[model samples]
Target: MDSMMMGAMSKNMESMPDMGMMDMSVMQACMDACAACEQACTVCSTQMMDCSPACMNCADMCNTMMRSMMRMQGMTPASMMAMLNACIAMCQVCMDECMRHADDSDVCRMCAQACQACMDACMAMKDMMMASA
Candidate 1:
């Protein structure tokens, strides 16, 4: 992460009530993965693949998830859980969609890999939160 982003995350983490329950390292990894997945999905969607719609939706969701993590003060445990569930659902759709075109497009394959990584990271985050709770 850039210095600016690190500063922003530090500032945001200060007042986050639920932040205490979260593992900062895990959160950072998930947030990064989500951001990457969003960018990859966006670029891949523009290629006019058959999965364009799903990729577009996943891109938006991943971006939102990334932003939400950065601004942790606005979230509660319930909100965080909901966001995690939504992200997982979006990732599932994106991975499935992208996998359909993986054989024909390198971008699609990479996008699917990103989505899978993001999903795994998010799930790990949820597990961490649960363990802390």
Candidate 2:
């Protein structure tokens, strides 16, 4: 996200009751990672390999995760955590599947890397939330 949008999100988040004073930078990183992972998975899915199904599933999960993060209203801490966990799990599955074909396909390798990055970003977001809690 751009600085203006991020500032707007930070201001918005500060007003929320359930998610008070969140680290917007962490949220931004997570969102960016999710977007990148989603794109990578989408591209990888078109390769029609064994990992296609997993890639498609992961892309959908990442898109949902990003959208949920973008809309913070009505989202409880528990729900946010659940979403993060689900995203991480889906990324793990996609990464594992892609890694199996990493040697044969550069696209799979790139997708797996994106999945790992997304997992790490989501983990960081989860850790930040837990610590604040």
Candidate 3:
């Protein structure tokens, strides 16, 4: 993350009330992972592998998740949880498919890493939400 973005995120965290809402750190991590996953998935999709379907799906899902967080007021706790679950599932599917070709494809390996990072971020967000609740 860039220093400017880190500063903005820090400000946001400081401004937000600690009332079971999304944590900025967790959200930032998720956003970063989603962006990485999207990029990786796009590259992997261009490889024309059998994993293209999952890669495309994951790319779309990650983009949506990142955008949703950017406009997070539209989401309730229920919606947030549902979105996280969907994103995690999408990442899992993408990771599984990419792993099939990981030994032979650099794109697949990068995509799998991005997926794992995204999944971890989503899980952390869920855990934080539940703890705050």
Clashes of each: 0, 0, 0
**How do the residues 1-133 of candidate 1 rate in per-residue lDDT, one tens digit apiece?**
5657776777667666655656677888898899999999999999997888989999999999988887777788889989999999999998998898899999999999999999999999899988987
Of candidate 2, the 10-residue stretch with the lowest lDDT total is 12-21
Q: In candidate 2, what are the lDDT values of residues 14-81, reduced to their tens digit?
A: 77877855888899999999999999999999999999999999999999999999899868999999
TM-score list, all predictions: 0.90, 0.97, 0.88
lDDT agreement with native, every candidate = 0.88, 0.94, 0.86
Model 3 scores worst on lDDT over the 10 consecutive residues at 13-22
Clashing residue pairs in candidate 3 (N, C-alpha, C atoms within 3 angstroms)? none
Stretches of model 1 off by over 4 angstroms after superposition: 3-15
The CA-based lDDT of model 2 is what?
0.94
Error of 3 at 112 (Å): 0.8
* Candidate maximizing lDDT: 2
Which is better, 1 or 2, measured by lDDT? Answer: 2
